[model samples]
Target: MTERRQSVQQSPADWVARQAELYEESGGTEGTTMRGAPCLLMDYRGRRTGDWRRTVLIFGRDGEDYLVVASNGGADNHPLWYLNLESDPRVRLRVLTERFDARAETLGHEEKQRVWPHLVEVFPPYADYQRGTSRDIPVVRLRRV
Candidate 1:
C-alpha cells in the first residue's frame, strides 16, 4: 500500500501564502513568475510538526533536474524549507502545470562551484545574496524519483 501523506499548512508569511494559493488555484497558469523569471512550487513536510509546507522558489534547469537556492535572502540561517528537507528529502514539485515527485539533494562544494554560475544566470540577485552573508548558501538539486 502507498504511504499516507501528511497534511500541510501554508507559510506564515502573507505574501508566500497568497502566492502559493494563486499558483495552485490557477493550476500553475498564474503565479508562475517571480521578478520576471520562472518559478516553481515546492511542497515539503515540516520537520517539527509533520505538516505540509509549501514555498514558491525561482529555479534553473539542469537537464531534467531542478535547482533551487536556499539563500533565505542572505540571512545567517538556512531557510526552514531547506532544513526540513534535510531531515526528509521526499517532496512534491509543480512546474507550471506539471506536478511530480522528487527528492532533494544538497550539492557539495565541487558541485556548487560548477552550478553557481548557472544559477546566477537564472536569478542574478543570488550573487548579491551570497556576497551579503558569511554562511554558505545551499544549492539544492531536486531529482525525479
Candidate 2:
C-alpha cells in the first residue's frame, strides 16, 4: 500500500460499516459481508457520475497479488464498480486496513476458470453463483501500481 493510494477518500457511513464487517471478519468466516465472500470496501470516483462509489468485492490471492471479479454473482447487470473502473482505469483498493494503488484489467477466459477456483477456495459460493445467469463473469487483476 502506498501513501499516494491511501490518500484517496470515501463517504457513506453504511458502506464503511459493511467494509469493516467484511474485512475484519475474514471473508465471512466470522460474519457476512453481502454475498458471503470476504469483502473489501473499494473506494473510487465514478467515471461518469464523479461521485465516490464504495463497492464490496470478493478477492483471491494470485501469488502475492490480489485478484477481484465482476461476477455480480451472475447478475443480469454488470456491477457498477466494473463500469466505474472501465471509465476511469486507475483506482484505489483496500483490503482490511491496507490501501493500494491499482489498475483493474480483465482476464482471459481460461485464466478466469483457473483463478476462480482459488476464489472458490476462499469463498465457495461463487461456483454456484456462476450457474445462475447467462452473462460471462469477468475476472479482474488488481495490479499494484
Candidate 3:
C-alpha cells in the first residue's frame, strides 16, 4: 500500500501563502503576477525540517536562466527561502504554466553587476529595495537541471 503524501508548505506570510495557493490551484493561469510584476513559484526542502516548502518570487530572465533577488523587502538578513536554497540548491520552479527542476546559485558581485541593470528593468522596485538596505541584495541564478 502507498503512504499518504504531505503537501508542500507555503510561506508564513499570509499574502505570500495565498498567492502561492492561487498559482498552484489554477495551474499557473491565475496569480501569475505579484503587484504587477511577473512572479514564479519555487519549491524546495526546508533546511532544518526537511519538509517541502514553497514560496513566490519575482523573476528576471538572464539568457536561458532565471534570476531572483533575495531582497527580503530590504531587510538586513537574507530571506529564509534564500537560505534554504543555499543549504540545498535543488529546486522545482513554476513559471507560468511550465514547471521544471532547477539548481540555484547565488551570483558573485561581478556576475550580479553585469545583469543588475536588466533585472532592475524587469522590476523597478528592486532598485529601491537595494537603496533602502545597507546589505547588498543577493541575486540568485536558477539553471535548469
Candidate 4:
C-alpha cells in the first residue's frame, strides 16, 4: 500500500499563516525568527479532524530538548495546537534546516518550575503572559522520537 500524505492546515491567523509559509518556502532559512526569538515549525495531527496541522512556535533550548509555551497570548484557554498534542503527542518539528519526529511532553509543576526561569530568559514576554492570566501556562518539552 502507498503511504498518503495529508496536506497541512495552516493557522487561521494571518500572521501565523504567513510566517509558516515563509519558513517552509525558504527551507527553514527565512521566517526562522519571531520578534527576535527563534522559531520552529511544528506539525501535529488534529484531534477531531485527524488532519495534519502546522503552526509556528517560539522555541527555547533545554539542553538538547526543545521547549515551547502554551501561553496562547495569556488567554484563558490553551492553544488549539497544544490541545491537539495533548491528545496525540506525536509531532514533526522543523528547526531551521533540520526536520525530525518528536514527542511532546507537558512538564509537570515541579519540572516547569525548574526550567521556567530559563524559558523566560528565552522570551522575556512569557513572564508577562503568565501574569496576565489565571491559568497556569503549560510548558511543553519536545524530544526526538
Candidate 5:
C-alpha cells in the first residue's frame, strides 16, 4: 500500500493552523463550522512548489457543486488556493467526514452574476468584501469529479 502524505500548512495565521488541526483531527466533524456557517477543507497542489496545501473555507451549495469565493478578504489579488487551483483544477475536498475528488472552475461574469446572490445569502460578508476592493472577486464552483 502507498503511504499517505501529510498536508503542509502554508498559512502564517495561528488560527488557520489551529482550525485546520481541529478540523482535520476530528475528520472534519468538530471544526466543520466557520463564522457560524458550514466549512470544507480543500487540498490542492501549490502552484510553484507542487506541495500539498490545505485550507478551510466556508462554502455555499450550488446543487451538487460547492461555491467558494476568492475574496481574500477583499484584497487586491486572489487567494493563494485560488491561484493554485488556476494552475491545476484537480483538487480534493472534505465536507464534514466525507472526502471526495473535485474540479475547480472559475465562473465567468454571467455565471457569477447568477450565483452571487446565493453566495451572499450564505455569507453576508461576501458583499462587503466585494465593495471593499476595486478588483472583481472570483467565485469558483467545485464540481465533483
Candidate 6:
C-alpha cells in the first residue's frame, strides 16, 4: 500500500489550496470552515512520492494540541488523508492564526473512547458520521513536534 493514494474522483475540490490561501490571507485568523463545520488544513508529504498534499479535517483542540479523526464520514474506507499520514507521520497544520509542526499517531482504544466524545463535541456530525458506516473510525491526535 502506498503512503498516499491517488486523489479520489469524488474528493472535495481545491479544498487544500483554498484552505491554505484563506488561512494565509487571514493571517491565520479565518478560512476555518469546511462544509459549515470547523476544520483545519493538514499538510504532509507522501511517503512514497515525497510530494506535498493537504486535506481539510474536522478538528478539536486539546490543550496545546489538535485532534483529527479518520471518519471518512463513516465510509467503509479510511479517508485519503489517513493514508497520507500513514505514508509520513510527520505533518504540518494550520489552525486559526497559527501554523505548527505536528506528529500524528493513532489513539489507543481506551484513549479513543475518551477522545471520541471530545471530537463529537467540536462537530456534532461526528456521532452521526460514526453511525453511517461500518469501518472503525480512528482518532488521531496531532501534537506539536
Best by TM-score: 4
Q: Candidate 5: misplaced stretches above 4 Å?
A: 1-6
State the lDDT of candidate 2 residue by residue for 1-145, as single tens digits.
2323323334345765555555544643432344655665566668876765566666887876678878776787788778887887666666766666777788899988888878878778667777787887777887778
Please give the TM-score that candidate 5 achieves against the real structure.
0.93
Give the per-residue lDDT of model 3 (tens digit) for 17-106. 999999999999999998788999999889999888999999999989999999998898999999999899988899999988899999
lDDT of each: 0.91, 0.68, 0.91, 0.93, 0.87, 0.77
Candidate 1, 1-145: lDDT as tens digits: 1356655588888998899899998999999988987899999988898788899999998889999999998899999999999999999998999988899999999999899999999899999999999999999999988
Rank the candidate models, highest lDDT first: 4, 3, 1, 5, 6, 2
C-alpha TM-score for every candidate: 0.95, 0.74, 0.94, 0.96, 0.93, 0.82
Which sections of candidate 4 miss by over 4 Å? 1-4
Clashing pairs for predicted structure model 5, backbone only: none
Candidate 5 lDDT tens digits, 1-145: 1226575654666887688789889987798887888889888888898888888888998899999999898899888899999999988888999988899999999999999999998889999999999999999999998
Determine which window of 10 residues in candidate 4 has minimal summed lDDT: 1-10
- Quick one: best lDDT, which candidate? 4
Ranking by TM-score: 4, 1, 3, 5, 6, 2
Segments of candidate 2 deviating more than 4 angstroms: 1-17, 20-36
Question: Candidate 6's residue-wise lDDT over 1-145, tens digit each?
Answer: 2345454222255766677677666877777887676787777776676767777777887777788989887788998778878877888777777777789998889988987878887888889888988788898989988
Q: How large an RMSD does model 1 have?
A: 1.5
TM value for model 1: 0.95
Superior by TM-score: candidate 3 or candidate 4: 4
Off by over 4 Å in 3: 1-5
Q: Residue 134 of candidate 5: its Cα lDDT?
A: 94
Q: After superposing candidate 1, which stretches have Cα over 4 Å from the reference?
A: 1-6
